[model samples]
Target: MAGPVILLVAAFATLVAALLFGGGAAPLVIADAGPVVRWGLPIVKLVVNLAAAGMLGALVLALFALKTGERAFDLALDTASVSAAVFTIGSAVTGFFTFVNVFNAAPSADAVFGDQLGRFLVDTELGRTWLITTIAGAVITVLAFAVRSWTPTLIVALLAAAALVPMGTQGHSGDLANHDIAMVSLVIHIIAAAVWLGGLLLLIVIRPVTDRAPMIAILRRYSAIALAAFVVVAISGTVRATVAVGDLPSLLTPYGGILLVKVAALLGMGLFGAWYRLRLIGRMAADAASRHFWILVTVELALMGIASGAAAALARTAPPSETAPAFVRTPAEQLTDAPVPPELTFDRWFTAWNVDLIWAFVVGFGLFFYLAGVWRLHRRGDRWPVYRTVLWVLGMLLLLWVTCGPVNAYQDYLFSVHMVGHMLLTMAIPLLLVPGSPVTLALRTIRKRDDGTRGGREWIMWAVHTPFAKVVTHPLFAAANFVASLWIFYYTDLFRWSLYDHLGHEWMTVHFLITGYLFVLSLIGIDPVPYRFPYPFRLLTLGGVIAIHAFFGVAIMMQTGLFAAEWFGAMGRTWGPTPIEDQYIGGGAAWSIGEIPALILGVTVAIQWSRSDDRLQRSQDRHADRTGDAELEAYNARLAAMAEKDARAGR
Candidate 1:
């Protein structure tokens, strides 16, 4: 009770102070919505942010920290439900206020005003975003209250996270130079912050009802989660600030100052998290230190409030970066929302860079976790093959390059480069990644939890063994999916979607990677799956896939028409090959460069098949040696009996 009250009071106070300091609520020169609307909008938005955090955080922590069917788990869900209700109301109110601010229309009983408001919600992009957000919030509110089990609760949590997406899209990213990067960073920042802040709030709520032993255990689990959240929050925050501030000189501006205050609050919270992780969590197991832990928690919540306030105020403060230029610079720039790069030279293939922060993080964390797993095995006197580690590192590095390097840098303008990235993502990288046998490493290294609560190890096990996993990892299905993906993605509107939408591009990357990984894993991976094809059948599957894959590429090469002509053809690239020529090159990449890896896979499968036969023959020879050819004697006896029966018949 005291925690929530204290947090809100602190948040409101700081929001008011920051708004005044930043002139966020100052009178606008044009289309001013008056003092009440200006002040009221930010205040309502702040409430929405807090409510979102509480809804999502409680659900996430409940999934990770508390055992199902327990009082603590139920209480966490209850908290989520209550918070979701608040979120639903807050989102609706925020939407109305936004409409008022944008249209400067007063709430009234007139039917004309009603019709206009209805049109605004239906017709405008901003209105649609808010309406969707409100609907998602309302859905989450019901689901959170109705569901208490693991899977259902998890679904609700995901929905709650999705509800935040509209807000992320509504931010200043649309007006920024690095639109994709800014949008992605803001989304990550919002979700991570929600999880961190909401989890702590959940802990505070469930403390009174939970046993001391379980409470401490939950605290320890949450500390791990908080640490991860902090890293994401910090990185995303840095990216957001870098784009928003433009240059160091802008740091002295009002938006920058408000951002600095938020940074300070985050730093303070990080320190408090470190203390709790290293020392306080352990001490809290004892009665003497429990009081101290709660006290510190209160202070940490206050700091979170300050951050929340500063963030809300920052939203209202215009960045020093020049507003998105009014005039179009070029056709490419108009379409891509970015300037065209210099000519595509041979050297640019190696030297060019365009960082996709999402993949960069994925690669970073993937390497870190994989190496950590291997290290754990070594420390336990187990010898994980060194080659696996090397291969995994190579795969991750290649993925990093494909996603964040030259291929990514030029893919938007050059169809050939996009195909190059696709090949690497689907074929080359998966070839290396499968042999690394990441799942095997994880199963061998990650400590299993005896507690009923699900942890990383438990979740991993659950995922791999699920019915859906069985279907996807089946050799025939995986191969079919792998072959079908290339044709489907390249031939459909999905191709255009990937070109025009950042999320769609990310989806393509992940979808291809997974399909390829499943295919390879079924063939030659060391990780255990529900089933694997026999070596001969595996080769047959590979052969079928290669034929289909080649035909798809040939179809593309033979086509006179270009895919996504509006995008690829309209890129206005002067130095690169013509769009049709680039498409041909892309088809060549798919057929020629891509087939090299597929052939490699085929050869590897053949080798494993031969080795399997040799191993079986050795086992039989060892049996003969141990049993002195007993099977041979039995065979001879049976033959002699048949000969004696023939002799008797002749007599």
Candidate 2:
């Protein structure tokens, strides 16, 4: 109780001070919106952050550590319900203030004001965002009150986390040069911060009710989660700061200075956590040490308040220009949010670079966990195939290149380059990934839980055995999905959506990768599957898929009109081949580069089939050796008996 109260007071004081000193209050005077809307908006948004953190963090702790029917678990849910109620109120208040701030309209019950407000909420992007966030918060508030079980509470937590997305989308990044990257970074940062902050608050709240043993266990689990959150927050914060500060010298600016304060506070919290994990947690069993632990937690909570408050102030501050010499953008730059590069060259494939922070983290975490899994196997004197590791690493590297390199740089403008990336994601990368047998490796390396608690392995196994998995992994279904997506994606509005929306682009990548993976898995994968077609049927399926794929490519090549002409044709590019010619080249690449992986799949399936036959023959030979060819001898005896009966009948 003291910890939370102190945290709130410290945060509020810091926020007020930063706003007055950091130029955040300038808007009130400049816009003449008065103190109520100006001061009230940031304060309400701050409370929204704190309450959202409490709701999400408490739910995370309950899911991971608290047992059902336990006092601590029920109490945690109650805390979540209260926090969600506050979140709902805060979000609503923030939404209303955002309207006043954006429109500079004083609050009134007049029909004119109401009509304007209605239009703002229904028609404008910013208004719609806050409206959605408020609605989501309301839903979570109700669900949190009604739910006490693990799964239901988990759903509420997810909803609560998702509710932050709209707010994240409206951050300063939306106005920046790297809008997509900024949006991704801000969203991840918000969610990770909530989990980290909320978990710490819950720990303090439940300390009195929990026994020492259970408390320690809960602390250990939370420490692991917090460590992960800290890493995400650190990386995401750095990415966001780079965008916000723009250059090194800008750090002396007011906005940058406030950001630095937040960074320093984060560092202090990190150091405190390190000391707690390394020096204090081990001694927590002692009465004197436990007393010191509470003191340490109080100080940590104060530091967290400082960080959160500085963050709120930083949000209110204006960022430096990410684009230098701000000038009118060309149509190409307007569409892509970046300048057109030099003419495409062979060397440019390796030289061109565009950093997508989201995919970078994905690749980094993927590689780290894979290597960790392999190391776990090695330390236990278990043998994992070396090729699998190589293939998985290679696949991830390909994924990184496809997503973050030249392929990503030109995909919006060049149809040929987009096709190259699409083919790699769908065909080449999955060829390597499926052979890695990641699922088998995970099942081998991850420990199983016996206490009816869900863990990584349990969740994975559950996913694999679910009815959805069964249907998706079926050979005929997988083939149909693979073939159908190529048409549905390109011919329908999905193509336009993917071009215009970053989220849709990401979905397209993931969807293609999964469909390709499933197709390959059904054909020649090393991992155990729910079902696989017979070798002959597998060959037939592969052949049919190849034919359809080739026809699809041919259909594109033969088309006279350009697909996605509005996007690809409107890039105003002067250097590349014409859109129609580029589309032809893309079709040719699809027909040619795409077949390489299909050829590999064909040969792999054939080799496996031959190996299957050889194994069967060897098994038969061993049976003959053990039983002296009893079946063959019995057949000969029957022939002799028939001959003897024939001779006796003749006599």
Candidate 3:
């Protein structure tokens, strides 16, 4: 069922991508691109996205009912519910390709396309065949959906729909008069929607906290659902672009830039999710703080939404606005004087970092190996490192402090460079830092154990395992690192200042790395912290933070005026330097309108934590109920008596 759903999504993605990228059309082909897009494939994506969204909404509602044993939302869920979420995501993917087809460049042939899609598009034998295909597919899919519950019907319908999208585009190769209505926006929207749908399916199959029967078996089923979703998200995304755009420059265009970001975020989410499911979900079985899985799933779903929906809007916009001016009337050609070469500045140098060389070739990962191993050692007995761990950490901190200049300088205006900096400080560093066991080291370093301390182990344990620690390590606080930083830096003067002044820049880098690292750690549960908040609190906290952060990005995009700091403006690449388009893409990503992707991410993390917590709670309960362990009880009783006698003697 899951496989077929995915295949349908793939078919739709392929058709849309082919039209968008395969020399489809340029903005010149359609002056008023909005309506063409609105009527065309965009409508198709909208249908799929809306359907997928309905399914997810239903799933969430059903989950609530199941958990609480309530009947209130049953009708709504029943009406919306499809047999399988995995199928919905895949079918929705076809909808996305249909979405891309909407923004085709048919304005040049308005006499044929204006309020009349059946005109030039379906006039020819090829066009007529394509139209027939779409009608046929939509009908068959509906029939199939009725016959077989969720997944199978969705696959058939979606596959048929996918074949119809490219044919809807009214143009083909060598038809330069016709433009490609298939926008990046539409493609992104479809991808994001699929992820959202897939994630909801994951929720159904996963270990439902509310399930009272064959609980473990149910969890295994949930895992399978999540796996299906994961595969669909990846496959659909890949196929869409492969068929959409043809060349490297197309990928580099402003339209493509946004697509790149969405894809990157998806990739990151995928890698992170895989790690949790495949590796550490079990080790955390006894930890109380594992409930963060839900929070991660939520965030992942939300991000996916922003990326996809923004893409939908982008689909309606003109072709790459940053392309070479159609008619170049340059004063440089008129002037005989040789232009003086501008002196290269620090920002220029930093922005020009060949990431292939630095991030790929010279990551300096050895520091992590040594640092994490040394820190882990600190978790054990009184063995201090030959050298002080605090001093070592402080020194590494100094090295990172300098990353501000290099990282910031490398990203003049490109989002990708900025992303690299984000990755380093956030994802890579924190993963290593937690394993190094910074929290435990601080404790060992500060306390002198042999110095007549009463209730030493108990006191230390209590502080280490406090509610406060768990809360800080929770996914909510960690997401604050990612979501909040993006808001603070991008939407305000903070972004400019972080790159302008030395100190501000330093702190910016510092905060970025710390937050990023911490967020990942909190999700994964590698290190222990001081605050241990419950799952519900973490989910709400992270969700709220993500919404606010996404809003800030949206605000920046919606504005018509300049937003970058004064210094940034002086440097020539202000917020409004480019057409409001790129900003729009970024904003959409920030808004998380790509649909339910972030939610999925939040849930993925949350499930892992829940599974861990459930296992631990059961373990502790077993140990606590050991009425048959007479020797262990006797040992404790004897120890209690000896302690009493020792106190009396001292008195």
Candidate 4:
């Protein structure tokens, strides 16, 4: 009760103080929504943010740390359900306030007001975003209350997380210069903060029902999650701030000042976490240490409250550079919300970079975790192949390059470059990734828990053995999906969607990468799977897929018209090939450069097949040596008896 009380009070206190200091919710001189509407909006928004964090974080921790049918698990779900309900109400109120603020609508029971509100909800992007968010919150509320099992809870958690995304798009990010970067950063920031904050609230909520030993265990698991969440939050928040603030001097502005306060609070919380991880958590099972731990936790909660409040205030405050509305100066800027890059050159292929912070972080963490796993194996006196690590590193580096380097820099302006990236993502990178057998490495390295809770290792194992995994990893299905994705993506409205929507582009990248990885894994992966086809069948599958892929490439090459003509044709690129010519080069890259990886897969499979046969023959030879050729003698005697019977028949 004290902890929760302290958190809420501190949060509201900090929020009011910051809003006053920054004049974030100050009444507008030109289009004033009155003090009540102006003040109420940020307040309601704060509630929405906190409720959202509580819902998503508790659900995620429930999945990762709590055992099904346990008291703590049920309590966590109850917390999530209640938080989701608050989130729903908060979102509705926030939407109403937003409508009032944006349209200067007065509170009324008149039919005209109702009609206008209805139109706003259905007719505008802002209205639709909030409507979707509110609906998603309602759905999560019901699902969180109803579902106690892992998979269902996971679904609810995902829905809850998605509900936060609409808010990210609503912020200054949507109309900003680096819209994608800012949006991605905000999305990741909110999600990670929720996990970190909500998990702590869950601990306090569930503390009464848990024994000390189990509580400590749960705390340790949560600490690990918090560590990861904190890293993500810090990184995403930094990127987002960089985008919004624009320059270092902007830190003197109202928004930046509030942002600095939030950063300080976060840093305080980080220090508290370090203290817990390094000293307090280990000794907290004892009485005095337990009391001390709770004291520090309370302080941490207060810091989190300050951070959260400052964040809400910062949201309402305008950045230094956003004093005027963004205006598009060209077709390219209008289409991409960005200026066109300088013409692509051969040197730019290696020198240029347009970093997707998402993939950059992904590659960074991927390398770190993979190497950490290998190091763990070495420390335990276990042997892991050096070649596997090399391949894995190469694959991750290629992924980073494809996602963040020149391929990404020019992909929007040049179809050929986009195709080259697609080829690498779909075919080349997977060839290196599959042979590394990351799953095998993880299983070998990650500590197996005796407790009922699922950790990374347990979850990975569960996912690998699921029925869905079996179907997707099947050789035939994987191959079909791998080849069909290329056609389906390019031929349908999806191509245009990817060009227009940042989320769609990310989805395309993920879909291609997964399909490619699955196909390669089915063909020649060293990782354990539910099923793998025979070597000869694998070769046949590869051959059939190769033929179809080549045909698809040829089909693309033969297209007389441009794909996504509105987007590609409108780029206004003057230095490079024409749209049709670039498309031709893209098609050629698809057919030729892409096939090299397929050939590599085919060759690798052949080598594996040959080795498998050789191993079988060697095993038989060892058996023959142990039996001293007695089976051969018995076969000869049987043949002689058959010959004698034939001779008798002839007489």
Q: List model 2 lDDT by residue over 132-164, tens digit each.
A: 887888888788878877668877888988888
lDDT of 1 at 393: 98
lDDT of 4 by residue, 1-651 (tens): 588788888888989999999998787888899998879988998899899889999998999889999999999999999999999999898888889899998889999999988889899988898899899989888989999888888788888888898888877787566788888988889989999999999999999999999999888989989998999999999988988899999999888899999999999999899887679889987899889888888999999999989988888887775645455468788888777899887789889998888898889889999999999999989999999999999999999999999999889989999999999999999999988999999999999988888888999999998899999998878988988888889989999988999889999999999999999999999898889999989999999998988898788889999999999999888788999999999999999987899889889999999999999999988988999877998999999999999999999
The lDDT of each candidate is 0.89, 0.86, 0.45, 0.90
Model 2: CA > 4 A from native: 27-30, 148-154, 322-327, 620-651
Q: List the residue pairs that clash in candidate 2.
A: none
TM-score of 3: 0.31
Better of 2 and 4 by TM-score: 4
In order of lDDT, best first, we have 4, 1, 2, 3
1 or 3, greater by TM-score: 1
lDDT of 3 at 171: 24
* Candidate 1 wrong stretches, greater than 4 Å: 624-651
Quick one: how many clashes does candidate 1 have?
Answer: 0
* Candidate 1 TM-score, C-alpha based: 0.97
Candidate 1, run of 10 with poorest lDDT: 322-331
Tens-digit lDDT string for candidate 3 (70-182): 23223323324352233344444333333334445333455644435445235544445444544543444344335323233334435533433333332221121111112
Cα-based lDDT at residue 64, candidate 3: 21
Write the residue-wise lDDT of candidate 1 on 1-651 in tens digits: 688888898899989999999999999898888888899989989999999999999999998889999999999988888888888888888888888889989888999888988898899988898888889888988888899898899889889988998888776788888888888889889999999999999998998898888888899899989998999999999999999999999989989898999999999999998986788778876876888888888989999999999999988888888485776478888878887899888898789988887888899889999999998888889998899899999999999999989998889998888888998888999999999998889888877888899988888888888898999998889988998888888878998898888888889999999998998999999788999999989988888888888887888889899888888888778786899999999998888877899889999999999999999999999999999989999999999999999999999
